[model samples]
Target: MDNQKDKILVVDDETSIRRILETRLSMIGYEVVSASDGEEALNIFRKEYPSLIILDIMMPKLDGYGVCQELRKESDVPIIMLTALGDVSDRITGLELGADDYIIKPFSPKELEARIRSVLRRVDKISINSSIPSSGIINIGFLKVDTNKKQVYKNNERVRLTGMEFSLLELLVSKAGEAFSRASILQEVWGYTPERHVDTRVVDVHISRLRAKLEEDPGNPDLILTARGIGYLFQKIMTSN
Candidate 1:
């Protein structure tokens, strides 16, 4: 029960919703912190340095988007904006503003829990990758992986990635054309043991994120390929396209 592992922040104007989220998240061993509006959220965010944020797009002051923008200026903490089911614009705005993910309103608590667990797992994987030893850059086609610096580049342009995202990319690129199973990815990327019931759908979410960051076209991905219900493959980008 590491205290640092449990840190989270919840921002929503609805008192009942906030209270419910606080209670539910706390019951699952998270250090829950809540704020009613964006202004207070910014203050608490700076003071606490939370690991993840559950933000509401609509608020009285500052709003979730503003809060997300302010936080993005300081850190790469994961954010999940809560938006209405039909509010398509806010979802785009949230992602464009550097939010990590988003959730529509009336979401099931279980889904939220799954997302939290996924984020925590991904963050943990990133921490481990940073400490591993890498002698030099590993390149496949136009993709360049620098283990020593823990950096990546495509055709000379630097590509930004979170810790887990980088590890996942490196693994696939390191073994280009070989498709891996969901469980195989969990064991290799996350270091999760066999007994753990870790949901492998997390792998899907991460691949999506990686595509958004690395692909010229996320819809028809050329780098990260999905094998229906199987897993993913990393295609070498031989000469820019």
Candidate 2:
């Protein structure tokens, strides 16, 4: 939440672009770190461990996708890429490489600021998810998830979960502990706010990931059971083991 401590790494090849971005971000109270190329960007990233990254797709020495692939293998930090090409394919590729969001070249300063804030907020929530204590953990005899603390325990053992997956589990288990529609789940868990629908496949992926880690058998899920045409449910724990 501290703008000073929450650093932003702007990686771009063009000097003018970097200068403009740096000035804009700094004016708005953000601490800006700039890199000329992908290689330099990686160095700064490793040294600074910035909370959020604003990467440009085209760069010298190393391209955006290559750098992103390397970074994602190590950390799950939020990344919002800048695509000079402004092509839908480029955006899709960036997303495929674990980017949180993307903006075309010549984007608005206000829009950039908004995206950065959104990403940082989510990252902050994720950091707290594994630490804070929720009101309660949805225990379903076999599995348990503490929504407040964002911790998952299965068979009395703590289980690791990704951020989005944890959000999905919390949404399902905290509510009626019953099935809900996929569209609803996407809206609630993934923060899909726009009128245009999001990729429902994303939910399917997260659910599969949660079941694999929490359930003794991921194929046949008991904690997150599917109801035909309805959605999925997190059966409430009647008795704790």
Candidate 3:
């Protein structure tokens, strides 16, 4: 069981919810640290540097958004936001603030655990394969992608990207000019199956975030283009070094 220990930080104002998550996650081989609010969560985060964070959007003494913004300034640790609001804007806001994933409140424990597992798997997979390249250095005009380093540089300056963001970009660039539907992207990037009733907007949110980080003019992206009634496709590399 020593090998199964991955510390998880659970941040929520609700005691019952935190207790429930702590118990359930602990049972499944994770070491859980519970925080009642965003401030406390941030304190614990700096100290523990947990493997994953389960954050609540609505919390006293600094909301999840603020904590996320603060954390993004230094860390790219995976964050799964818990929100009571079902509005698409709220979900997008969380993603824009660097949350890896979001789940609506009143969700089942199993579903939350599944999301945690999916996110951790993606993070771990990226770290393990950082040295391997699916394709060599791809040059996209002013942007350069060093797949071997799992890095992207814009005008020679490194562009910061989260694990999932890089994964999404890599997937698109891997099959340049090939339109990948939202459902396909969700399956490939998020490990969500077609049988699962997952929101396709997740793909759109991630794509929008990628554009913001990687494109000089996110308003009119040139690298990743929308296929209009379909999905998105990356332009093929015109040069490679």
Candidate 4:
């Protein structure tokens, strides 16, 4: 029986928000560490190495986007951004910067907890699957996907991808040539059910991100293709002898 608690890093400028989250999350069996600004967040992240991060967008000295971008450069630890209400652009920016999820301000602790669990669950699933002995390497064009290692390489060079990005890619590559609807992708990749009605833009942004990293030409992607009316698919790469 593993009794180890998941550690979460909460980054916010507000003392109230940090305190509230720390208290509530601790009560729910998570080990919570917090920072009042982005730089502090990075420092704490380096030392604490939390399993997940709850990052606030607005902060003194480096903001959430900066921290997210910096973190993405070296770590794939899950990140959940806390954005201001009605800030669609902010949410999109956070997602583009490799945040796994976003929650608007004034959100209930219960809702945040649910989002945290969902994101962590996805990460855990990937970790467990990667640990399986049957997992093997997948070759698509110049790309190499190692399911056991949960890593991607392009033209023999490693491509840095966030955990969510890798999960999405793994799903598509696992069933190449299958068109997955955006809603279906949300359900399968993000672990959101149909009734959850999650914004499909999350799917689009992640697809775009993957293309930018894996495709020779993101403007005309050869690997990840749009299915016209349905959604998207990973093109089946044909090898010539």
Pairs that collide, model 4: none
TM for every model, in the order presented, reads 0.66, 0.68, 0.90, 0.90
CA displacement after TM-score superposition, residue 83 of candidate 1 (Å): 1.5
Q: What local lDDT score does residue 57 receive in model 1, on the 0 to 100 scale? A: 91
Q: What lDDT score goes with residue 131 in model 4?
A: 26
Better of 2 and 3 by TM-score: 3
lDDT for residue 40 in candidate 1, whole number 0-100:
95
lDDT of 1 by residue, 1-241 (tens): 5533678899999999899999988987899999999999999988998888999998988988898888867777878788884745546677666665566788888878776777666655432333233454666565677755658788889887765667677678666778888788866765553333334545667787788877778999877999767788877543221
Clashing pairs in 1: none
* Candidate 3 structure quality by residue, lDDT tens digits, 7-63: 999999999999999999999999999899889999999999899999999999999
Error of 4 at 155 (Å): 1.1
Off-target runs (Cα >4 Å) in candidate 2 are 126-136, 139-169, 176-241
Residue 240, model 1, lDDT: 20
At residue 153, candidate 4 shows an lDDT of 88
Give the TM-score comparing model 1 with the true structure, all chains together. Answer: 0.66
What C-alpha lDDT values do all the predictions have? Answer: 0.74, 0.72, 0.85, 0.85
* Candidate 4 error regions (>4 Å): 1-3, 126-135, 194-198, 238-241
Provide C-alpha RMSD values for all models, in order: 6.2, 4.7, 2.8, 3.0
**1 or 3, greater by TM-score:** 3
